[model samples]
Target: MEELTLTTPALLFSAISLIMLAYTNRFLAYAAIIRNLSDKYLKHQDASVLRQIKNLRLRIQLTRYMQIAGISSLLFCVLTMFLIYIHYPIVAVWAFGLGLVLLILSLLFLIWEIQISAKSLQHHLGDIENHFKK
Candidate 1:
């Protein structure tokens, strides 16, 4: 295999930083939505709103997992760079590989969350349709 230099891990820095930024933004959006939902639930306690809250709760948890995996990926990449700096090329390669795996896991979580989000939207749409039908 080719040499695992510091530059190899350094290359991931920009990509990981952007991903972390996106994940943070997602978390912030969820927080805002949760707060809004909480207020609505407090005021009315409607079954529909409660269902939405439950959906949001699951989405928020998945978002947290995504953030954790993404952060761990960044941490591993940093570790890889450190290992390279200390002249452990083999170990650096392994660390970098682990980082990649974590990143992939994060993306998988994101996909799952998105699927759930779409389903939730569809449920809302179904409610609207039922109201119109009535």
Candidate 2:
């Protein structure tokens, strides 16, 4: 097998790190938005707000899971990159592939969570509309 270069692993690690950071930031922003909405509109003891809060809580939990996965993947990528540089090309390749899989899984979970949140919001809006009709 040809000797592995550090550049390939280094670039992969950098990309994974950036992706993880972006995912973490997205989770934080989502949590902030939910909190702000609850504080502003749910103060009147509205049931819909309560439902929304519950949905947000679930979404946050999923986001947390994804964030954890993303971070772990990034860490593995870095470690593998170092191994590759040290002449363990086969091991490094396996590690890099595993890291990539983890990152992809995290992204899939994030997408699912967002879809759930959107569905919950749509349901809440529908309920509000029905309230107005009566």
Candidate 3:
């Protein structure tokens, strides 16, 4: 196999940074929506509102996993670079591969979270649908 260069791992730094930024933004947005829903639930104690809270809780948990995976990818990528610097090419390759796998896992979680998010919005849309039906 070819030698692992420091630049190869460094290339991932920007991509991971951007992904982390996006994940953080998603978490912040979800937090705001959850707070609003919780306040509404407290005031009225509606079943639908409660359901939304449950969904949000799941989404929040998924986001946490997504964040952890993304961070793990970055950690491994950094380790890959460190190994390369220490002149360990074979191990560096393994670390780099693990980092890529972690990145793929993070993406999968994001996709699942987004699917759940779309379904969550459907609850709100159901009201509009009911109105039109009547």
Best prediction by lDDT = 3
For each candidate, the alpha-carbon lDDT, in order, equals: 0.90, 0.79, 0.92
Output the better candidate (1/2) by lDDT. 1
Ranking by TM-score: 1, 3, 2
Model 1 per-residue lDDT tens digits across residues 1-134: 57888887788889889988988898899899889989988999899888888898999899899989989999999999899889888888999999999999999999999999999999989999999999
Pairing residues by index, what is the TM-score of model 1?
Answer: 0.95
Model 3 lDDT per residue over 1-134, tens place = 66779999899999999999999999999899988988898899899888888888999999999999999999999999999888889999999999999999999999999999998788679988998999
In order of appearance, the predictions have TM-scores of: 0.95, 0.78, 0.94
How do the residues 26-122 of candidate 2 rate in per-residue lDDT, one tens digit apiece? 7888779787877867568777667777877888888888888788788778878788768888888888778778888888888999799789778
Query: Distance (Å) between predicted and true CA of 84, model 2?
Result: 0.9
C-alpha lDDT (0 to 100) for residue 126 of candidate 2: 91
Ten-residue stretch with the least lDDT total in model 1:
1-10
